[model samples]
Target: MRGHDLINTCLPDELIVEIFHHIESKSTRDACSLVCRRWRRLERLSRSFIRIGATDSPDLFVHLISSRFSNVTTVHIDERISVPLPLSELVKKPDKGASSSSALKLHYMKENNGSTSAEGDFDSLCLSDAGLSALANGYPKLQKLKLIWCSNVTSKGLTSLARKCVSLKALDLQGCYVGDPGMAAVGQCCKNLEDLNLRFCEGVSDKGLVELAVGVGKSLKSLGIAACAKVSNITMEAVGSHCGSLQTLSLDSEFIHNEGVNAVAKGCPNLKALKLQCINLTDDALEAVGVSCLSLELLALYSFQRFTDKGLCAIGNGCKKLKNLTLSDCFFLSDKGLEAIATGCKELTHLEVNGCHNIGTFGLVSVGKFCKHLSELALLYCQKIGDGGLLRVGKGCKFLQALHLVDCSSIGDEAMCAIARGCRNLKKLHIRRCYEIGNKGIIAVGEHCRSLTDLSIRFCDRVGDEALIAIGEGCSLQYLNVSGCHKVGDAGLIAIARGCPQLCYLDVSVLQNLGDMAMTELGEHCPLIREIVISHCRQITDVGLAHLVKSCTMLESCHMVYCSGITSAGVATVVSSCLNIKKVLVEKWKVTPRTKRRAGSVISYLCVDL
Candidate 1:
């Protein structure tokens, strides 16, 4: 409060706009709107969301976003939003055999700059049509609009943004090249659109989704149509006869079948979150999404090779408000359809079963004896689940907390000490390519998951150094991945740099006795290490990257690929001592040519020849 603090003449502009809405960091309300002019007119009237781009400057980016977010209600134009354009301004061609009168004068300069078509398709638009008619006449009460990968917005800039906003309600056109006359001019001018995402829009079909389900399908409610390959089943029977108040439907089609998922489970019976990818579905479209969406609750079934397990036992006996279920690569689902949806959905909670190979361990011991409000569980490549179905899903999911086991080769150490003595409120444990789990099953998940904080033991080659000194004396870690643990070295990197000093992401890549005194004991007991990926550690060198740039000062990124004893003077003392280093992947004999031009003048020094 020192710079002549007239704190808005001592508070009260409605308590400084309620203390700037508790300053939810948009760079701290842009450094309190540079501390003046009444905190820059109350932080531009509490910015209602603005991400205008397409390389800005269309009339000074809609006159600085209509003179500072004039009640802006969401807008995110893309193409990296800004700072892009220099590929010789994109239009390139004529470099073939000198002259035929300079190749018919470069084909009449590519037909007078309409560089090969559709009125020069916004020549790599960074938001065109006069920045969508100055963001539809300056955000005419704009209500959500996201045109990612801008791809030179079309349909005549979405028909002048649907004839000027008309109270739009959520419209996300990803990788936009707008078609079907921009979805029939956004379903005949927004009709109060209720969340519509047309991903990879391939000139929309079924005649622009039956003219956007006859104009905004009765005020649609969440509709995402992905990879449109001429959407069929007559656009799901015209979105099951005008969307009937659809409630979240994401269809990544393979020509959706089972009569287009039973006409969206009998025309959206108030559906609740459904994601179907590359469909050709069967099990009569999961038994018509189990008796017509009995209020479904998040269901994701990817690559349905003829959905089976009797359509997951008719969505576990008629979707009793099923709670989050994802079954990827559904190889004719087994474990008798996950033990009849864990004995008929006992309010299951987040479960992902990847590459399902006949759900084993008796359908995960009936999803640990009836879900018990299970919490996050991912069992990848379910190789006949082991340890007696993970000791009956760790003593029947005692409110489990994040557990992902990939390539479960009959997981060992008695299912990692029975999920570290029955989950004990576990906190993220990812064991990849489980080589029959070792190091006494990660010291029984570091003495019973003492509130673990993300631990990944990849390619667990007998995870060593006493499982990183019993996970640095019972966890305090913030992400530690022992990548391909070849008998972890430097006494397990100095016992996780003195037992995770609030460690921030460390992956000991191909650890073959990692050296340079374990990157100088992980920059002296991990001074908040910020991302260290030791790739193919052929005993890291340059005296352990000058003791990790003389003690990691929040080192941002350091990936040592094929570390042939890193050189170029230890990547020039980590691009002159960290200075919030942003990325340094070494190799190619640790890049030299004068430390690769002084590590490209501070950070981002790739070089890999590994």
Candidate 2:
């Protein structure tokens, strides 16, 4: 009967909503909406997005996500909510004699934001202001909203979600308790807001960011006010006189200096990415970001210890279409600011220099004699970078592909065989605590990179097992961090599970002769292994994590800190065979309350103390 006419026909509802839009996992459209009732009304009209966390009653989980998702368009209020909801019938406030006037000028905005007060965690979760006005009157086509650390969302619940959503377009009140009349009612009602992230919103200041740049700062395009310490410089001169199509800006405070970055570089002339932390900015605000960000391309400067080298040689003689440049703790830049960024940024391609100790090796051979379309390079704790300035950056860039050398310690082995013979189009390599890199510079970077996929050699301790069997007989690796190498054991993790069988993230923490035959040869050659951190591996036991939960199976997070030879029935046989385990950081585990009452909505435990 042709499988009973494909299970009793009656299909067409736009062909069963185009076969449930090819079922794109929301737990498989909630198991095909329990298979039946017309695929549960086309998986409730293809859910538009709903994420309500820590419910055990945050007022009946915001009234069952506003009467079960009435065409939701994005809502995420997660900052810790796994059931525990008893705050003595919370959500009341608003009526300390009808407080307003920007809530009495942010009544000490929770003792100056820096967090620490979830009413002494009587099991947190307090989404007041009438649970965000009953989740903006039950999602009337809500347009993106994320309220993390809600701590009783104030400012009258963000002015009732900027007056009932009004088709809002991205608003993330990070570390919440909104201020400035809930950002002047979300800049006078959404006005089609284009991404606004108020990080650490300590009762927002600068008159609610100059009334949110006089409302929606003319269709604001990405603005992140990091650590809102009463934003200064008159809110960057009213966001440079009304956000002229702003494109990404993150400013950490300390009363932002250099005339508030010369009033956002003479007012956001199509600003394209800028992050300045510990801002009491100098170098005359990076010489006014090379005289007003001429379509700047990614510029990051953290803890500018009074940036010198004449403010990075005036951003390489005026940011010539700069392309990603990050400098942390700019300790009076040296090598004459890399010879003025190899004679003014020649279309740079990502260069990160951390703790610049008066630059070295002629400032990395003047960035391998002029950037040359460089591709990602990070040099941390630049202790006068040696090995002839990384062999002149592997003979001058060569389309370099991601290389990070932490604690440089004058890198060894002829600058790792001159970056395995000039870059070779490398793919992510981080050598931490480079203790004069051994194993012949990790077998010349596993015999010439081989399109290596993320390899981290931490605490090098003379790398072991013939440099991980020359990087498991040559690359194909997917994130493998040999933490504190201590002579990595189990034959360099069975030669990196037989030449990186596409290993997906593995961190051998404190490798003290890792046991269980390298977790049964990384569960028989990494069956899509997803995240593993063997913390303090005292020879990982529990029969090698019960043969790694019967073979990875997309294992999600396992950070066994201080592995005192696993017990509690091997952490209750890894919460009874994986089932897509989500976080299990053990040590002192009484089988974590019987795997949190038999996978209580999917396992989660982080018991420590060895």
Candidate 3:
């Protein structure tokens, strides 16, 4: 039907509103609201809003907040994505001018008057007081709110939201964009909040934290305030005094060092999980936590630069019942720490030491010897975990369910054979960048882990189509990432398409050899596929992309980074078809001016539904 004919036949307003509940693409549903006055009423009554992507334009920004976006949770400002911000606040500041060298940096943009260009580039969607008030009035039933990098948001926003939304529970204001005043406002007003994630909200001080502790400690169960540059021992002591029943806590390495760990050790009697992320914490803090929070079962500390064998040993001495541990960047850890864990934490199930450069064969051997119950392990980027380490782990960990050896350069086919012989319960495996382990290793995965669900072998040069064919045929997989491997071409993609009927997410990013045949095959076989990354795949053209978009109605996201064959036509085809697409990434696809205008039109439809 022509546009006018289709308009006349457009379903009744009530019918459209019913359909909106099932539709997820924010822009498309918003466009429906603009179709007619009757549709607008339907959109309003349907309560269709989920995520609101912010822009810097004051007018558009204000209009958005004023709009009645029902369920306005998980807001994403374009600024956080288009104009990327630094993540330097993840580190501790050294004395004197060392602020320049902190791991994360803050860069804020001034308010803009006009809507950003159709280019979709934006400095974070900074909210003003008026905007906040408008938001409070508009979204009185929001459940989750995210101001990840919105620097201009102050305490007033929190107060406004709190006064309006009685059911608000989760809030993420990481990266200090929302400061102490705003945080204090949130604590005071949003008392029923259960999960508060302030990962790097640097402007927050101890006093604000105290107010938070006093207001929501009883109701709050999970809280992560990691990477706050201003957190001191006094504030931690305050938390200890008041926030006694927390089930989960995340502290920066610096905060844990200044006797704050001792406070939590003594104060939080019901804590079960903790994430001590950052690089400044000392071993004493771990010891204190072990002695203080005796019930800790899950621990995630990615980058304690000072953490070593001695520090981990202290953990073995203390947190004996550890069930899950991720020590990704603890570079100085050695066999002694593993020995201690093996001897003490008998229930150790999930373990990840992604970049612990010091751990070697001895550590794996000890874990194999003592931690017989070890089920999941990640030794990614640990260059020293060689074949010997894999041999020991495979033999010892009989119940191992998942193993990630990504970037372990010393691991070879010998490790694969060992793994194939043992660890029959494996479900998920990632071996990216271990070039020495070729087809043999991957074949072992297929033969051994018949229950595998998720698999990733990015940059594993030795593996090819043969291994994927085996995996795709043997295991009913759900997720797979085979990017950066050149030798695995159409055959592998075809095998996966034919075998893995449940595959939803496929990441073939940087694998340039994938052709139209593979893309077509995916569209034909994987009807359940939702996401695919074709970044740097030069062989893919509009033919394959259009097929994928047209056939895969479930496609929600597609990345065309450096896939030069992509043009405005292909993108337009996506807009007209794949009705579920919520996100599309094409950095330099050379969209014509007309195509850019079309893209802008698409954005207008997707902004946010009231």
TM-score of each: 0.38, 0.36, 0.74
Model 3 lDDT-worst window of ten: 101-110
The collision pairs in model 2 are 54-81, 100-103
- Candidate 3 yields a Cα-based lDDT of 0.73
Cα lDDT of model 2 by residue, 1-610, tens digit: 6557574376666776677667777888888788887777666776777786765235435654566557778888875755444322342345657546434323422322224556533322466676788788888569999988877779997888688897899988888867798898888988889888888888889998898788888898888888777888898888888888888888888877788778878888788888888646778887887877777888898878876889878878887888888888777788888778766887788888998888888877888778877888899999887888778878988888988989988878788889888988889888899898888877888898889888899998988888888888988888999899888899879888977888889999999988998899889888888889988898889998899779887888888766889777887787688878777776555456766688654434555443
Instruction: Give me candidate 1's TM-score against the actual structure.
Output: 0.38
Error of 3 at 454 (Å): 2.5
| Residue-wise C-alpha lDDT for candidate 3, range 361-396, written one tens digit per residue | 888887877788888888878888778888988888
Instruction: Please list the C-alpha lDDT of all candidates, in the order they appear.
Output: 0.80, 0.80, 0.73
Candidate 1 on 222-321: residue-level lDDT in tens? Answer: 8888888887788887888888889998889887677877987899899899998865768887798899889999999887787679888999999988
Better of 1 and 3 by lDDT: 1
User: Which candidate leads in TM-score?
Assistant: 3
Off by over 4 Å in 3: 1-50, 55-125, 134-146, 156-171, 176-194, 215-220, 253-256, 396-399, 507-524, 533-610
Give me the displacement of residue 466 in model 2, in angstroms. 0.8
